[model samples]
Target chain A: MTIVDPIIFNAFLNESKEAVESLEADLVKLESDLENKNLINSVFRSLHTIKGNASFLDLDNITTVAHEAETLLDEVRSGKRKINQTSIDLVYSVVDVLQEMLEDPEMAQAIKSVNVLKVEESKIEHIVSLVHELELLRYSMEKLPAQLEGERGDISEGLFNLELATSKASRITSELGAIVFGARLVPVNNVFRRFPRIVRELAKKLDKKIELKVLNGSAKLDKSIVEAIADPMTHLIRNAVDHGVESPENRQAKGKKQQGTITLNSFVDGNLVVIEIKDDGKGMDPDLILYQAAEKGIIFRGKENTMSDSEKLGLIFAPGFSTAEQVTDISGRGVGMDVVKSNINKLKGMVQIESTLGIGTTIQLRFPFSVVVASCLYVYIDEVCYAIPLSQMEESIHIAKGELFTQSPQRLKSGEEAMAVYSLQELLTGKFQIKQGIKELPAVRVRRKDGRLIALIVDEFSIMEEAVIHSVDSYISSIPGIQGGVIRRDGLVSIALSIDSLLETTFKKIPLAYAVNKERKHPEITDLQKLIEDAREITDGVLDFKLS
Target chain B: MRIYRRELFIFDIGGVPLALRMEDVEYILPASEITSVPKTAQFVLGLAAVRGKIMSVIDGGLRLRIQRQGTSYFVVCHVRGNTTAVLINRPLEAKNLSVKKIESSDVERILARHKLNPKMFSAAWEILKKKDSHWSETGRKFLEINTDQFVSDQMASKIIVG
Candidate 1:
């Protein structure tokens, strides 16, 4: 092993580890249907591959365990021995040893200590002989049924016609296609199952009376997408308990139930899967979030009053923005939500937060069915090509370059109230490189699900086509505005820009303060101020004290 | 004791002869159609697709701060399973040499002899600090490149600061 090339060893380790994990899963499934030939064959193949690779590498320990497991499975397959509970346990023991060896190969020399593999040869031979005798007896008994069927005569005349066969073949092919598609889909419960235990343990640890309710656990998503979302989902659940839910006494005083509830609901909406994590507790207060964002320099001071309630809620997803009064070991060093947002964006998903004061907060995440295939609108930014996922792009319009420089951009026909235009090249590279004296420019009017609209200026726009986007290395994907890259049919990779990341980063920066006249003209602010004053009078300055 | 003999793929970057252990070298191809990725470290030229894998091309001249002539080829090497391409002036030779592993304790002495700061060889220092046995071997004391450390160091120093 010391002589082995590290690269080859790593590749082998990865492949063998995956095979072993699948084998573990299949072995449990095999217990229910030990007689299923296809499943038994699959299990056999997994073990054989591991053994062969291990033997090639001269990994004596892994090879020995896998080979022993393979020999036992061969006995079951050959009908020399039956796959009873005892034999299944034997195979499981082998898998356990193999797993330990894979995690630390240096433990291989201790393989001699694995006493289960040293089963007595005479005991195994006796069981095989007993099973062989029973098989022979059963075969003799089954021959009587065949003799009875022989008297029924040939029924194959009209049953096997060309038309029927052709239709059956077509049906089988379609069924096979369905099976293949479904193979990539797994139930949402695969991830949801872990949450109940997590919530229970966390509730006990935090001394909070919180109940987690998971609805629609049977909803399905692509296996890859489901795996990708597991961490974010866990983070949200933790956040709900640690930060969202009020303590029991606090909840009682607030005229709520003593125990809080966190609900995880997943369902399919059109071509996308929607997963919502809703917590019934003290909701996210926009003003407090705004103050935190201001304090962190994520947003300019005094700009908090300018943003709407929903816009302030969006600030929680800004990097290093946390509303927790104190950092806890569990989830809130200010890095939680932004990471969740980025992971969701990497899945090409959208996140929407809806909260009411003292009511609750629900964070809704929507992901497309497949992360690999996407419909992207390809455009050229300074003659370099880039891709924007069509899910984020609402439309493309031809606008004068001067329009982009205006303080106020025209609203789109989609009826979004506020629209801002920015040069895509400037947003990406931090420098404007548009050629001198350019007049008309192509722009993409992109809107996130949360209803923030921005038009990005580009040199030219091209066709909107679905392309397979491959995720790049983290060194590149970790860049502020990049989601992944798409390998074009020409075998060149074009970067797929993340509209969510660009919007989020852009929104966090200081914006030019509104004109004095415009501030007075907006009625909403006056109404909100009046409401705040009314609340202040009713609460006798308590709200003022908290804000101060 | 058996002498560990390995092949070193020697190549030129900015007129300096450097060699990477041949086992890490995946391929060498003509440098063409390199797309520039914006907002990345200056050392990173861009991404190029070769055989369906996107490889980040690093400008060896910029990375090593060496003035170089025209880059003729991309020396593609694997760093922890990810392929990265480094521009080279030209192909030199593949030489088989006997390499002797230097202990971590001797690293400071070697750097002192070369009058190099530990920060200058920060990646090698990190490996030694971690007590990793896979040291950059001494084969005639010619600069033997550990592709993993070299590329990762470029990523850490250049990308993070930029």
Candidate 2:
């Protein structure tokens, strides 16, 4: 036996693991449509790559198992054997075994004694025939290129300028290379492909039928953002499967389809990529989440009575808050959703949940399409340049410094709405020294996601342009008022202000009465809070009775 | 057995000469435009772009409690995977020295006199000093800095103002 080089073996091991993951995803597709010849061929090629690599490394155990699986897929592809649910199950089992063998070398050794050699000696001829066909096809493909050259000879003298064409082609190739190198958008399917298998296993374990539909899986996003959100997306999916979906019998009694449908959809909305996970399961009750929040001490008692229904629903993201009545191995450990929220926040993204009782629930996560590229309005503060994302900028205006100080809390009137103005320099530097010569202050008016507006005082404003944002070191990122650092066209590292975090930190310092007066000015929000409180009280009584 | 010699790159910060391992210094470049970062330590001068990569530049004078002087050069060093440049007046030529000749007692005496942490300096040298384009026999004690220790200590004790 040839001893495999450790480095080559490790490389092959990593490649084989990825190949198996692709095979598992392909198998999921084949399970739904047995006659999907394309998917079958893809799975066959994946297994063939693994088997061939393993054989080259002289790993007999993996090579044998992968060859068996590949031969079975080839038989199905050639119509020698019919594809069915049983065949899909067999392939899934083979994939599971392959995964186990790759993860544990001891498992591979144990499987060596299982006598896989009894499967088929006749399949060798079939494999040889397939190889011969592939070689013949490759020969024809090679010949076609020569035939195309011969055809081009007839028109070459009169129509083609070879020198000009070569130069143009070279220029175009270089430009294309530059564009490809600069491109940062990766298909969301890179992350979405793992979920079909997850939903399948979770559905089976929970004894529920689930149909997962992924739309716009090809929508592109920043690779870092996609990787950052994968864990949170997994947590959300697991929670949806474990806590949201009911048993088949319960669904039947409720007059809904026995198989629950969960749709994962993505789309580009302006500068953001919006991903929504919607499930046709028992919807979340806002009041139940509020009660859970209260029970877990996440919120003060009676605080639930002052929140809007949406705010009450948002309580589900509070740490240590879970609506699960019993602890289960699947998800009820009570540590899922809050982590999802915090992870999203770390990516500077937002998660919003909307649910209608007995109807369904949709959780939407919106993130900037490209974290690196952002159009920002540059503002100068204390001789330093700061870039504010254009998405957060409402407008820029000049206000007199005297007018800002005349008001007790420093409010600015933009149209009819009164926005609180804060000195950007003072807030960021924490240096509240009085200026002697400044009369007019340039302020950038920005809006947060919650629809509150604030004017940031600055020295001056610069032209708006798209800038590449570079992540600051962790030590610098931990500081408030700074999101990340951005390299300007001039190669200066300017601070990228996190407008939402800055506004949040500023609002915390506002006095109690000013905040109340602002809330009172928006009476509609107050009324909605009251309405939700009443609804929560009634639903709390109903839930208590049901629990008893 | 081969005797190994350590290469040291000497530089001046706040009129005091300091030596660092030659391998630790990536490059010595003229001071470039630096962008100031808020809420970092006062010694953290700001960030400067070097070869398309941003590096945090620190004032070695302020860090060592020495009198501040305008920096004309930057000594870029990478420590523990983080690249930073220390502001310096000038960098001298590299020198090969016997690593085993340096005594720990000398390093301790220099640290004690400067009131610096003992971990900051790895080695000490008492050599003739050069000033005003002339080499003189004035005995000057130079401390070899532990770049990794200095960077890790600065990052750990970073103070962020609200």
Candidate 3:
């Protein structure tokens, strides 16, 4: 049957393909469970699915073979035949062949050619005959007990070609696809089982009894995203265990409960998945971070001595930004939180630190509920448009001509040597691919969290949502101005800006340390540099420098 | 179905006028205000606000050694996706002429009186002679003065005689 609506057809195709893939995995697993009669039920169910799907797709030849397999499985379920290795192999082969007919064109043709009739009547007749023999054999087998079975296969697995054998195979495959998405949570005591071990272990070392609490072990997430976050989550947990939980004797001396509490609360809020790690152990010291930043030359020597708490906290992400002196088996190197922040950012997520010295500390990271559908800021450079996720964006602003001034010296604080203002046209030429002459310039001011801003210049602008992002082949060098090229709706290739690349190039042009010393530097900076360059003329150059 | 080929265009850069392929330049907007940035080439003035968006302006005449007229006039052009508004001496009127060669195939050898530097063609020149191989008097005279070889050859012989 012809399907006009691609969405419904896609869903149907995906579901049936998933069912087919599981059928193969289950068929292989049935070899050891042959003596067990319940295993044969799943075998019957899988064959039944194959038969059903083949009919839906109007594949009469495959339906006939699948119906025969289902009949044999049904007979085995009745205990008329003895479950054996030879039987399993043959059933596996038929399943494999059925899958081939659905997935491969040559094989489908071969199956139809071998069968004289490829219709519902012929398929039904073949199944009825196989069932008769299996029923007779099932009657002679031993009796067994029956119990409920767990859902067999996860949807994320891509094992067999039972589903989606279209001409556009690449278009069908997905990275985040889940075959049988989890709708309900099953109770598992994973949260409680680990708390006792964690508390006991921390208490012995720090001389403080710590109470560990884990909440929402029953909540579920897509297996793929969960798989990606598991290790980083483990790191957060380990940080809590080694740093958040305090030892027992110190708790008693502080006139508090002998057990300190470490809480790991996970929950979902709309499209956001938040994992917060909080502790009641010795709190973080802002002074240490500021001191370390100063020592590493990240800040002025005396700046740490008077820095604000939040400013000190911001220094935690600075490179060589560790304050922990000793190297421990745990996360004592101070690189943990920085790496953690980087990892979370990779997922288009954010990590924040909140700590009160001697009180407690909390580290929170926020991830989107479903990353599949992302919100991106659409921009164009070199006549190609690109989508940059809004999650990674900081802010957008504009600087007027001449109003945009150098923050430190030669370059503007935004780190662009050419005034932060640029048009979409000039940015495209920098790509070095178009090989065309100069056009108009279009630039936008984008702010990054690190207090740095960049002016993104490009050729054109469009805010369209892109379904798929395909990178241009290496045969074509990526233009310096545009990030890469992707196909747009009208089949025209559009350039996508690589934000990171633009920022990097901008930073290279306008390093903050560089100061421009034009002949007339607003009368003040020139005087200041004059005092440093040649001292004699400075006294007269300063005409009532504003005290206000 | 009718197909259109993008033609070549030239616009005012600041006040200095320059010629370019129309395909290279995306679109043009009016020049209002430009932000001056440091550590750039002499021709690159700074960024500017064109339309509702900001743009980087370049002195195209200075960039290409073309003469400029005023600071108020500017032309926008794109190169490799980067947009730059070129400042020109004066705005040049655009011509949609169908030229025979695209700089590579249109070289002609004819008799001439004065040899001017071809590289300096952006400047004005006077013609002296035309091709005597198949020429009229006016055409011959025009070509003799205009051909670069004729002018260079005269200058060389004058130096030898002196």
Question: TM-score winner among the candidates?
Answer: 2
Candidate order by decreasing lDDT:
2, 1, 3
Order the candidates by DockQ, highest first: 2, 1, 3
Ten contiguous residues minimizing lDDT sum, candidate 3 chain A: A141-150
Clashing pairs in 1: none
lDDT of each: 0.67, 0.69, 0.46
Classified by CAPRI criteria, candidate 2 counts as acceptable
Query: Candidate 2: where is the Cα deviation over 4 Å?
Result: A1-182, A186-238, A244-371, A400-415, A433-440, A511-548, B1-4, B68-71, B99-117, B126-141, B152-154, B157-162
For every model in order, the fraction of real contacts preserved is 0.29, 0.38, 0.00
Docking class of 1: incorrect
lDDT of 2 by residue, A84-156 (tens): 9888888888888888878786534433433211112333453455456556545545444444466644434
Task: Show model 3 residue runs off by greater than 4 Å.
Answer: A1-206, A218-220, A302-308, A371-548, B1-162
- Model 1 bad stretches (over 4 Å): A1-371, A401-416, A436-438, A448-450, A508-548, B1-4, B99-142, B152-154, B157-162
What is the DockQ (computed on Cα atoms) for candidate 1? 0.12
lDDT head-to-head 1 vs 3, winner = 1
Shift of residue A452 alpha carbon in model 1, Å: 3.0
**Tell me, what's the RMSD of every candidate?**
24.5, 19.6, 26.5
